[model samples]
Target: MSLALPLQRTEVLVIGAGPAGSAAARQLARAGFDVLLVDQQPQGRDKICGDGLIPDAHKALARLGLLEQVMALAQPVSHVGCIAPRGGRIDVPGELAVLPRRELDNLLCQAAQDAGARFLAPARFEKPLVNEQGRVCGAQVRIGDDVHEIACDWLLLATGAVPKALIAAEMCERHTPSGVALRGYVHAPSMVGRIKAMEVVWNKAVRPGYGWIFPAPNDCFNIGVGVTDSHKAVSGKGSKKELNLRAIFDAFCANYEPAAALMREGKLLGELKGAPLRCTLDGARWSRPGLLVTGEAAGSTYSFTGEGIGKAMETGMLAADAIIQGKAKQWNDAQLREAYEQSLRALKPKFDLYQRANRVNAAPWLADLLIWRAKRSPRLLARMSGVLRETSNPGNLVSLKGFSRLFLE
Candidate 1:
């Protein structure tokens, strides 16, 4: 059963008030646009994530003037320790930060509100309202029992991966090698002293992707595993019911003596949540006249490190800039698409190349070899770190001279 509704108007409508949507709304509102941000969840909603923000992510937030607020709630991480399946450890010196997604998202939304963007939380989005020509004019939203049609000049979809509305409208195509991420927060006994670092352990049992233990504030930590669906099928892990993440954590603790000691004193703080990870670059279509998509809705996440915060912020900012310029100039779909694609190319090539390399080197033996080489050679380590940080151009991959210099010299 469907009901027709009267129309409301706004200058800009941003869907999904996550990091990407909030960032876009904040920038657009600061630029003097009347931005209306909407999300299905209520305020202070929690998201499932490792909550580890790398230094580059901090840099992006600093540009948006939200660094101080984020720092206030975040726990500093000064090192990243990795344990290989072959039983060797490598410690890298760098700064990272962690905070629960609840705090971070709330802070970002507050910032958006302060910048003059109106928010409609707990507002369920039914679908995009497409014009006769198929250009999205706004969205059909349900607030409580009533459905309202919102009119806008532009619609930005910052909705994350599971955007059923967009998929139903045939605006997005799904592709991949999808995977499952199981995450939870727990209290563990202080191992390796204080909780100032994030630890990644690559064990045989954790295939395709790795397991991570990231320190959160107040002696709490986020523990998670990312494993491809195909890997799970091959491993004969029955079904999701039989392969619960909490059980996997217990198994890991049992197998690893050090981890076992930590769990003995640790408390299981909450219910574990499972989320899907799209492993391929599937959704690349961005604009159709009045419609534009950014962040995970556009597949801006890097498949390699599972890091989307920085990329989402970057894309959101670029989208705002493009929208402002396009609206002012009355640009067409081709023009907007060109601008958006250029923005993605500018901000994404290095990270995309890194993801490609990771997919190519998916085998544990190859990963072990690369890690060993990186650990042994300072220059290689620096180059790898630079790639990870997205501070270098991926064009270096095509340059024979640069490749030789990086790996051999």
Candidate 2:
């Protein structure tokens, strides 16, 4: 079949209409740039995710004028319950929120549209359009049977982890690490009448990651297991080499006492869905002349909490700023590269610290010890929780004097 080629033009083109793409498109359009947002799936489509939004996400939503819509669609979670391998529990009190990705993404896309961004939903990005000088000019896309070539001075890639088009264009490298996420929806029968807390169950059997049960509204819950690729790589001793997140979940529900109780009262409501988790923080081929990358496509997803929505939004906002400034001043590659690098530099330290902390938690014994300590000391738990939640930096949690007082006093 001959591919029909249609032509269009815009000032800025955003690929992928997820949180990051929509956020950037909205910000850019608000700044008076003729922005076009494109996505493979139609509007109101669902993306697989943990569906839990932290406080930082709330702040981002507010900035995007999405807080009201999000609040209306989401349920507020007030606590996090941690369960250890030995059946020990640590309940940390905090404000958390949950919403399905379908609702959240739709809300964000709508906000972008409201801000004057044109959306091309159900459109697949075919490839990047390159000029004779080898610089990216824009993108070639397909909406159903019609192919369209959209030209822009700036191209922003917010295409999530599986950036197939970007990889195909040879604009970015792909690393198929063994990390996997097995997630499903479950009916929380036991917690139906009670205020539910987001839960994490840690065990050595589920090495390099923990199992989670996050509360959703309407008596439903999102439960999953995130296993590291390192664990999968090491487990290749036999036929059972691949990490079976479903098997892990079933085993936990069947064998682990607390988990068993929770499952016995709950109903498995959906099939287990799996997705690849990129573990590396290596940036994508971000810029070549007029193009840039944002969100997971640029490895902006935090290796620590696997949280990318907030970081994606933050980076998207910054990218919009850089693009606006770049366009106004006829900025060269050096200026744009400097701006992108500066943004990453400012954000990387916190992400690096979080990754280190995640490495610590991935160790079953270390996680057990930390939970034990947290259970024994509420103050320590609060400080640690603050660090994990990214509400405060780890350095500010305690000083030498405070550490001395924890034991010395």
TM-score against native, each model: 0.87, 0.88
CA error at residue 287 for candidate 1, angstroms: 2.1
**How badly does each model clash, as a count of residue pairs?**
0, 0
The model with the greatest TM-score is: 2
lDDT of 1 by residue, 1-409 (tens): 1122456688899998888899999999998999998898976888877788876678779978999889888888877776667766656666578898899888888888999998886788788888998787888888889888999988888887674755644566553324557788778756536445687766666655667778888788887776543223223222332345555665666655555555566776878787765433444466776777887777666665566677777778888988878777888777876887788767566555656554422454545655665577787666655654666543353344554654674
Q: What TM-score should be assigned to candidate 1?
A: 0.87
Candidate 1 lDDT at 19 equals: 84
- Where does candidate 2 stray beyond 4 Å? 1-5, 193-195, 230-241, 255-258, 328-330, 389-409
**lDDT computed for candidate 1:** 0.71
lDDT score, candidate 2: 0.73
Q: By summed lDDT, which 10 consecutive residues of candidate 2 come out lowest?
A: 231-240
lDDT of 2 at 232: 36
- Consecutive 10-residue window with the lowest summed lDDT within model 1: 230-239
